[model samples]
Structure formats: C-alpha cells, structure tokens
Target: MTTKVLICLYENEVCPRFDLTREVLIAVIDRDAAVLKEKEVVLPQASLEMLCQMILTEGIQVVICGGIEEEYYQYLKWKNVKVLDSVIGDCKLVLQRLVQGRLKSGDILVE
Candidate 1:
C-alpha cells in the first residue's frame, strides 16, 4: 500500500505557519518505506481555503506542517487526514523521519 504525505513548505524548510504557506511537497511512500514519487505544488496564492481544497483534492493522507489554526486542524482531522503540525526543520529531514515512521507533531528538527 502507499500513503500520500503532504508537507507545507517555505523554501526548503517546513513553513512556519500553515495559512501562509504557498508551496507544498507531496510524497508517495510505500509499505517498504520507499518514496514512490515526489512532487512540489505551488499554489496560486496563500489562502487557507485554497490549501484545504488542494489537500482534499490531492487525496493527501498525511499532512506535515507548522502552526495550524484550530479550526483548520480540526477540519482536516474530521476529514481523516493525519496532521503533523508544529514541525520545524529541513524538508529533507522531515521526509526522512516520516519514511522511518518516526515523524511526529511538534517536532523541532532545526537547531
């Protein structure tokens, strides 16, 4: 089986705020922990509503992001997306940890 994980991005790191994110990195990981595919999606603009729509439309199963609003967080959860919020780090490191099954919400990987 494969899981789709979306990481809210700012340059090469996790965006500090979810609603302000304009870019996202999506990865498809398989049961063996190998990334089957990866893609970067640039939104037309930073809008919470647009982002939420993209997340659902893209079939994202997991979300890795920083500082999310309670309403949005709860909404995603209600939709069955696993949100790993409050994460701060290099996107590569975050992805590595995720593939290893160790990534978590509130993770601070930057020094």
Candidate 2:
C-alpha cells in the first residue's frame, strides 16, 4: 500500500528533538516502497501542535523523528500515525532504510 512519510530534519540530518524541529521532509511512496514524491517543508517556528496538524493535513502515515515526547508520540499514535522515534542519521540515509522497510524506532545510523 502506498504511504506518506514525514521526517523531521535539521541541517540535513534527523533533528535531535522533534519539538524543536523547524524543518521537515515529506515523501510519498508506492506499494513497492519506491519514492514517488518528496519535499522539504520549513516552518516559521517550532510548535508541536503545528507539526501534528501538518502531518494529519498532509495525510502522513509514518513519522520519523528523534526525541519525541511521550505525549506527542501517543497523540500521533491515537491519530493512527506510525511513529519511528529516536532515529539518528543523515536524512537521506534514513529515507533509504525506510524505503527498504529496514528502519526501526530507536535506530542510530550515524557513522
């Protein structure tokens, strides 16, 4: 099934804190896991509510982020969004792993 994924970014890397992130990468992928479309979104300010709103409005099915708070994580889950938290790596590399269905929560890929 096709899905939409959002990744919080900071300086081309996974943002260390989801609540503090101001930029995000959103991708649309097909059933075979090929990326169909991708874009970076820059927010004027960091707001957890804004982030959640964007994810829902954009039809994001998956979220890749680092250091997300328990409340926000639960909120996303309640909304039926799959969250992979505590991931640390280059944004591109993270995307690759995600596409391969190999990425998991709490994964650290920094080298």
Candidate 3:
C-alpha cells in the first residue's frame, strides 16, 4: 500500500471552475523509497454535504489546493485529514516533497 495525497492544480492563480475539480493527483511511493508515477481522478462537487461524504467514503488522506474555502477547510480538519494552505506551483513537485516529508505546509512557493 502507498500513502495517499491530494493536490490541487489550476490553470491560473484562483480556482477557475468547480467542474474542473480534476483528479485527486497524489504521489504514491512504494516501500523501496523510490518515486513512482502520479495518478489523477475526477471528483464531483455535488454540493457541500456531498463533498464531506466523498472524502470520508473515498479514503482521501490529504487535500491540496491553491486556496480552499475557509468553511470547507474546517470540515476537512475535523475529519483528521491534513489540509495545506497557500500551496502554489507544480502540483506534482509539491506532492512529491510532501510525500517525502520535506515540504512544510503554509510555506510560500517560490520560483
């Protein structure tokens, strides 16, 4: 089994669209300490209520987004899932560092 993670990718700064809620892109590493390919899954935002169920029911461990609504953030935290704020950059690298335990949440992303 691999430790799961979820990262948010956007074309620009802000979340452009809701339907564009693309995959739960995460970096899955095996026991060998090697990096593997990433995976993306399309998720649906049926509504606020549904989002909660989706996460708990889907076994999502972490959520990464450019910026999430404060309200939802609280809900996620309550569920015990790691929530990262103000993450910006190549979603893949961010997830990589996070999985490797090198990335610190809330650290500004610099080019």
Candidate 4:
C-alpha cells in the first residue's frame, strides 16, 4: 500500500502561499517510512476529477496542503483520502508531522 501527502503549491516546492490557481507538488512515500519519490503536478483544475486521477494514477493517500477549499476537502474525505489543510511552516516539517501521526487538524502556522 502507498501512504503519501500532496502539497498544493504554485512553485515546484513549498512557498509562503500555495497559489491555489497553479500546480501542486506531490510528496509520496511507499510502504517504507522514507520519501520514495517527489513529483510536481500542474493540475488543470483543483476539481475532484483531477484529484481522482492523481490518486488512481499515483496511488496517493493523504494531502498535506497550505490551503484547501471546502469542495476539494469534501471530495477528498468522501474519496477516503485524508486531507490536512491550513498547514504551513517548513514544507518538509508538515510532511514529517503527518508521517509520525503528530499532525493536528487546525494546527497551522499563520502568515
């Protein structure tokens, strides 16, 4: 099974803002607790259909993002993928907290 987190960002890496109108970076991990491979996805739209394609194509499980809209969040929840929103700070830190199961729902760094 694959357990992973996808961070929505404008740039290929994490920045101050996710730039909701742009692409998102995908951080993936396999069965092991190590970062397997990292890739970027320039999603056509932040719609549920695009998300479904990402999951089905890449086998992702979680989405650790800076910001997320209500519809996308709902879609992810209904699709059985964990969605961690309002997350900030170091991009890697967010992912680490998630990997260790120490992430909080509303624990986000405000800019």
Candidate 5:
C-alpha cells in the first residue's frame, strides 16, 4: 500500500510549530517504502484549519510536524492521519526515517 506523508517545514527544517507553518513537504511512498514523488507546498497563511483541510483533501496518511497543540494533534488523529509531532531535524533526514519506519513522535534528530 502506498502512503502519503506531509512534513511541515520552515527554511529546510521542520517547523517549530504546526499551526504556524507556512510551507510543507509532501511525499508519496510505495509499499516497499520507495519515494515516488515529492514536492513542497507553500500556503498563503498559517492556519491549522487549512492544514487539516489540505491533509484530508490530499489524502495524506501521515503528518510529521513539530510542536503541535494537543487539540490539533487529537484532531489529526481522529481524522486518521498519523501525527508525528515534536520532530526536530532537517526535512530530508526526517523523511528518510519516515520511509524506514523509524521516525517517531517527539524525535529530535538534531544534535
């Protein structure tokens, strides 16, 4: 099964807060965990509602972000989007771990 993952970004790094993020990296990975496609999305503004809408509309199965509020976190989970929050690292590194099934919530990859 292929999975679509979204990563909130800020200047090549994971955004510090999900609600305040304006840019995101989206990737499509196949069952074998190979990334088939990837792109960056720049939102007009930072809004959690918009983010949620994007996730639902784009069929995102997983969301990797940093410092999400409890409400939004639960909301995403309720929507069936796996939320990996509080991840600190380069976006590339985060995506690598995600594809390897090693990324976890609250993971800090930066030393």
Candidate 6:
C-alpha cells in the first residue's frame, strides 16, 4: 500500500500557518516508506477552503503543516486524514523524518 502526503510550504520550509500557505508538496510513499513520486503545487491564493478542497480531491492520506486552526484540524481528522500539525522545519528534513516514521505534531526539526 501507498500513502499520499501533502506538506504545506513556504519557500523551502514548512509554512508557518496552514491557512496562509500558497504552495504545497505532495508525495507518494510506499509501504516500506520509499517515496514513489513527488509534486509541488502552487495555489493561486492562500485560502483554507481551497486547501481543504484540494486535500479531499487529491485523496491525500496525511498532511504536514504548521499552525492549523481547530476547525480545520477536526475537519481533516473527521475525514480520516492524519494531520501532523504545528511542525516547524525545512521541507526536506520534514519529509525525511516522515518517511522514517519519526515525525509528529509540534515537532521542530530546525536548529
């Protein structure tokens, strides 16, 4: 099985605020945690509604992001999406940790 994950991005780092993120990195990981594919998406604007819509439409299984509101957090949880919120770090490091199964909410991977 494979899991699809989306990481909200701000330049090369995880966006500080999910609702304000305009770019995102989408990746597909296999059961052994090998990355199968990766894609970066740039939204036309920063909108929580649009983000949520994309998450659902893309069939994303996990989301890695910084600060996220309770409503959106609960919404994703209710939809069976695993959300790793309050994560602060570079996108590359975050992805690596995620693949290693070492990532978690409120994680700070930066020095």
Candidate 2 CA-lDDT value: 0.95
Write model 2 residue lDDT over 1-111, tens digit each, in one string.
788999999999999999999999999988696999999999999998899999999989999999998999999999999999999999999998999999999999987
Q: Candidate 2: deviation at residue 107, Å?
A: 0.6
lDDT measured at residue 100 in model 3 versus the true structure, 0 to 100: 66
Runs in model 1 with CA error above 4 Å? none
Over 1-111, each residue of candidate 6 has an lDDT whose tens digit, in order, gives 899999999999999999999999999988797889999999999999999999999999999999999999999999999999999999999998999899999999986
List, residue by residue over 1-111, the lDDT tens digit for candidate 4: 567677666443344333343566677665556777777777676565665567656656776666666876787788888877666656666666666667766666434
lDDT of 3 by residue, 10-97 (tens): 6423132222454456445654555465666555642445545666775667766665677788888898877776676666567556
Which residue window of length 10 is worst by lDDT in model 4?
12-21
Q: What is the lDDT of residue 34 in candidate 6?
A: 89
lDDT tens digits, residue span 55-81, model 1: 999999999999999999999999999
Per-prediction CA RMSD (Å): 0.8, 0.8, 3.7, 3.6, 0.9, 0.7
Error of 2 at 86 (Å): 0.3
After superposing candidate 4 on the true structure, give the runs of residues whose Cα lies further than 4 Å from its correct spot. 12-21, 30-32, 44-52, 109-111
lDDT of predicted model 6: 0.96
In the predicted model 3, the residue pairs found to clash are: 23-41
TM-score of 4: 0.67
Better TM-score candidate (2, 4): 2
lDDT comparing candidate 3 with the true structure: 0.59
Those runs of model 5 whose alpha carbons end farther than 4 Å from true positions after fitting are none
